[model samples]
Target: MNQYSTHDTSGAQLKLWDSAGPFETGAMQQLRNVASLPFVFRHVAGMPDVHWGKGATVGSVIATKAAIVPAAVGVDIGCGMMAVRTSLTADQLPDSLSAIRAEIERAVPKGMESSQTANHVKGGWAITPNSVGRAWNDRFEARWRAILARHPKVDGKTSDQLGSMGGGNHFIEVCLDEEDRLWVMLHSGSRGTGNRIGTYFIDAAKEAIAKERLDFHLADKDLAFLSEGSQLFDDYIEAMHFAQDYAVANRELMMGRVLEALRKHLPAFKTDKQAINCHHNYATRERHFGEQVWVTRKGAVSARAGELGIIPGSMGTGSFIVEGLGNEQSFCSCSHGAGRVMSRGEAKRRITLEQHAEAMKGIEARVDEGVLDESPAAYKDIGAVMDAQQDLVVIRHRLRQIINIKG
Candidate 1:
């Protein structure tokens, strides 16, 4: 086991797995702030990719008793990665991947830019596909109606954005593993509807705190939480679970579309049905340290023993398929990715398009100024991150992208 550094805070010790690399002070402060919360369990665990986030540190795992913080889970509920290995080898891919990339972009609506007419939004489905509608009605319709009946504000929003990818860090990629095996990976979450559910609850939590006159002082207002046994808490959990399911379905739909696109471009191929679908941003009820608690992995993946998970790298670097060792100190969690070393705005201002293009050399991805913020230099080294989390997970497959698409 790698030696972990510990810092004593007001309520619990902050366990950090970042001694092998630089630790940001802002993230440290956020971790301490979270640790100071009254209901925080044992201690807050900081992953190697820890960075400062809105209410809590992005890569920190917070296990709490009797309460749940909405913002700590963040607005992008159930945001995660899904990757599937295909029967086709790297050699089977066509020489030019431009057409395949374009087909995927067409099949999945990406980015925030939307075209609107008298009564339609072009960014989402004009007419919901039969498959998408069936999936929603079968899996979500009844539960969604219940949630809407309670929270009327989120009622008007439909599932039109169910299969669409949203802007910012969400992406799709075609990659080759070390054995030259092909895979398709994507990152996304429950779309507009999830955002509505999350925001509504966050505000509701804050209002409850004010109304009940809770005497706790929070470092950030976004840390407002709904206590266990409260009506709002039950409602949030139901809605959150629904959004999580939506996110998984969203990825599955996009994967099906991408596979169809690939079939049009390449020879016959089949995907391994045991593909991975894991969430990095979400909370769940679990047992730990002899008690039940809510474990919120804000920007971390659950690494329960022998569990499979995806740890993606930056646009140009290599990603990994990993197996968990279930280190208890980390609450059995691992870093989501090579966490951003710089903010997007900072990267855009500091990194030139020439440097961005150079960093992405050999990868078939957008190298324009618009994508400068997502360049490899904008993120921490993936190799170093894996090294720091040596006890949390074991690398299974090393994947380098041949083609990348970003929203």
Candidate 2:
């Protein structure tokens, strides 16, 4: 752990878990900015994967008293990871995994734009499945209607995107643990709806600050916030909770579809019944240091003692299933992944197609220029990241992906 004192009158400090490696100067500046906020409680805790983000540094845990920063949660309201252990073993899988990958892609819509034909949408469901429809109608329909009544700008395309995968770092994979046990893992979140809600609230926060002429001046305009007891604050809390629920349901729907697709090609397999579903990007009220505050984990996961979390590496690298130790100093949080070491644009310009293919040599995934930005070389070494946060979590299972499907 490393500490940096801003020497500001706010009396807040910056605590970082990157002693095993170095982080960008921009990320350190963001941390300092957050720590300097008057409402920030105690200090700002940064995970080993900390990196520069729009508002706060990614992999940061911010606990604030009577205030909330909408942009700190980012545009992906409930983005996270989910993993399920299956009964299938390595020997059960066929020598080739191309067929399985193809099936998964066919079952779930991926990439920026859903493929479409004259008659119907190709990537998404041409006809909504009964299960998905039932889930939406029973669980989300009413809440969505209520939200739309207030904010019509929220995307109405929720139904079609329920089980579809979005592009950019979101992925589904088939992996094997040390025991050769098979597990299916995926990364995604509330799709367009979450984006719309987050954008609306962020802008609303800025407007509220400006309209009231609040005495707050943020280091980054995106850090504009909503104070407690305000009507906009209540509205944002409601909408944010709804988006989070949608994200959980979205992952569940996709998991079911992926399992069904796998069944079509492989022998019958049963899941362990309990899957770890967690959100690394989101905010919730919690009692920290004997005070009720909003804990916003941006690119960080709740690591309350005995809790299960997933920390994935870039494609072609190993991932881990971890158990949290509930370290209080960190506000019980851990890194989301081997955080990006390079910007997407820099990665594209510096990494070559040949290098990407070589890095992902054995994995069955996209080997083209489209996926070059997410290559393993673009991120920090997972081993170093894990080493840096030994106090936060304990590894339970290490997984190596054999098949990776990137959106």
Candidate 3:
């Protein structure tokens, strides 16, 4: 059975779903802060992957009546996972995947620091606003323009940031499922444009609160929020929606590029019948507990009945494709992945090159000191993370990486 701890305040009641053994103190503190908020609709739901994050815990589901926290959505707006089944099997792959990895590096712009950011940039935009961005921008440009007009501070360069990969923990991989079928997977978010948009709005929210001289126990400056019906709130919503679209397109564009890379080395292959891309860090309006509210899922994947989602493992571990169980108590959500057990800085300091190389021996991925922080040891056991939420999502596929490109 799922276990929880609850807290009550005059403003709201909060519930945190966590296993007794693995919950972190930092996560609990963030939960406490959210519970103290005045407009919180119901209890805060924490998933097994719970960890400390900027405004809210990473693996939390927070519902609010009429206000939205910009930082809670995070700088990587619409950050999520994407995976596609392929016709290729493990047996079809070459003995050494180095060629495949190099081909992918050539096809997709993987590492931004090494690649010419200048080529990827246009008019001070970070992502180059490729065809994908242009199409999506055109569809929402009218709304975007209107919002920016009202809030003139809402920079318009975010559109050019689409289709780019952001740094840290974001990655692209080629994997083989338990049954040996190939799967291409990646994780990224709205790039420079998204960061600028998020930062600008977060400051605006804080300024709005400061202007009113409101009094409240804010856990972190990142918790500053825009109240519903306010002009700033409207602008954030519109801007965030556009960022979400950009994020989705960003992954799609990367996936296309990765596939092209595979074609360069592997035999002619086709994508399988199924593919899934899901956002785990964003908010949307949903009906729950007989009321309509904005549900913010931070490092939590929606687990509504029959919903398909991706739960990635750390580098050198197994990843899963899952179907939601629609457990209402969890806000119909599941953990995004095996949560980090240590900060990247700490992980890099704690783990050794020998350990990382050994763990990644069979995989075609980078093993240099640069990627030590993302070593599998830095994250919770994927098996344990999945076992903790058997009731939340049903496993559809268990995948192991063969080739991984960390960004």
- For candidate 3, lDDT tens digit of each residue in 209-328? 877766776767778999999877887888888778878888887788788878877888999666798998899999989899999998999989999999998989979999999988
By TM-score, how accurate is candidate 3? 0.92
| TM-score pick, better of 1 and 3 | 1
> TM per model?
0.96, 0.95, 0.92
Clashing pairs in 2: none
Which runs in model 2 stand beyond 4 Å of their true positions?
1-12, 116-123
lDDT of each: 0.87, 0.87, 0.81
Candidate 3 wrongly placed segments (more than 4 Å): 3-12, 19-22, 116-147, 151-160, 213-216
Poorest 10 consecutive residues of model 1 by lDDT? 113-122
Better of 2 and 3 by lDDT: 2
lDDT agreement of model 3 with the native: 0.81
As a whole number from 0 to 100, the lDDT of residue 92 in candidate 1 is 91
Stretches off by above 4 angstroms in model 1 are: 8-12, 19-22, 115-122
Give the clash total for candidate 3.
Answer: 1
